[model samples]
Target: MPSTQFSLNIRTQPSREPALPCHETSEQARELVRGTSLELYSDGALHGRTAMVAVEDPLRITVSGLEDIILSRTPGDDEHLIAGHLFSLGLIRTPADILGLAFPDNDPGHAVVRLRTTKPRRSLGPLPGGPRIDPEGIFRLRERFEQRQRLYRSTRATHAAALFKADGELLAYGEDVSRHCAFDKAVGLALENRLLAGVEIAMLTSRLASDLAAKAAMARIPVLCGFSAATSAGMELAERRGITLIGRIGRDSFTIYANGRRLDV
Candidate 1:
């Protein structure tokens, strides 16, 4: 079975029992799954290494588009991920436009979303309309981003996904070898916990591109910010999908590639 199939139920030896802080001798332990570990050696001397593989829950999403064409993918939660991705991309304005959500039986990896209005779809283009952060906001984005690089600090992992509000409050962060998985896990967690709607920006540690753009589009995110360059496809999709793509973000500067009309300041 894939590691994602492992149940989250961690069993512990100690059953529920009251603990006394005043006790002279006492034992307290928390249940945890032992992740993979490695014993290293240098010149016959012992070295230490350990690793954890987070469980990934694959989900499917079904979207009912024009002409009765139903688009479905293992997008996890159809309503939440779609709403979340779309909100982040700026293609949607309110949740009321969503007609309803449908999860088809036996499709373990997907769900379908139905919309009330069929807005005219736009082709991908350069950054068009969305809120833009000033230098102070950009500075804060970099500072908070630097502090969240713990995965890199510990394991030298390359990809990370961070969630931020329009005001720039850091919400959640995760890292993975696969940029898709990293953002997927972030979006998955947010959907599982019903927090996707509140996110205003998804700050990615990877380049702004189409795949990421697709993920963000599925979630309806209004803005996607990256520290790397944007791909042609990514730029195109962002424009087509009405998502603001921010790329080449530096410590003291950044560039807006799509939907510049929406950036108020």
Candidate 2:
């Protein structure tokens, strides 16, 4: 794949986008990732050090009139995860289909979502068009996304999914142990705030696999970029779904895996 270098200057700006707040207790949030004291054998000396590790837990999703779906993900934003998962599977058209989420008093990991959708459970077709991303803007958004990944920075074991406006505004953010779950959480956040339609670009901290690409297509996000790389199936899916897939993003340039014409070419 070829990389591009656009000659536009980029600038960092303050966050003005709407972001959903996690309503969980701080202690519960902290439990998602914990710090462990361990021995660090660097060079030739062994020393005690505390390292942060992401905790992967099971989340059981129960949707109305459907079978249960279980996911192993970091223990936060369970509702958003379920919403995004359902949306990706075409179970419900929009967040409006969701009536409410009920969690067991004994098990916060289990979520039961009541669906009041009148439409069909499955959907078809490619995503809509309107997003145009500048290569320069990609670098800027990558910087901002990295700065916001507090858990990833501390643990380096978490993946993240972020949705950005074409102009570089971050619309939503999701971090988790699973790349797919991260993307779903971000989409779920956008859906909750009714901002999914306004989303232009989706960024992933990990590689762009078929699952993430499919999720982006299902969520109707036009562009999907990854910090690492894009798998062959992911590239094909993005191309078929009218998505511009970008990968191997570096400070100076990024590789366009498919649908370059949709970019600011």
Q: Output the lDDT of residue 40, model 2.
A: 88
lDDT of 1 by residue, 1-265 (tens): 1122222221132334311111111121211122567777889798787764332334444445534323322222233334544434444444545455443553434445565555644424433344555545866877788788754554454477887777887765655555665676567456544566666688888999898988777666778889899999999988888888888888777888987655666
lDDT of candidates 1 onward, in order:
0.59, 0.77
Task: Give the Å shift of residue 71 in candidate 2.
Answer: 0.9
lDDT of 2 by residue, 132-198 (tens): 6677889999999999998787678899999988988889999989999998888888887778888
Question: How high is the lDDT of residue 27 in model 1?
Answer: 25
In angstroms, the error of model 2 at 9 is: 38
Candidate 2 ranges with C-alpha deviation above 4 Å = 1-30, 44-46, 117-120
- TM-score, candidate number 1: 0.54
Best by lDDT: 2
TM-score on alpha carbons, each prediction: 0.54, 0.84
Clashes of each: 52, 0
**Poorest 10 consecutive residues of model 1 by lDDT?**
18-27
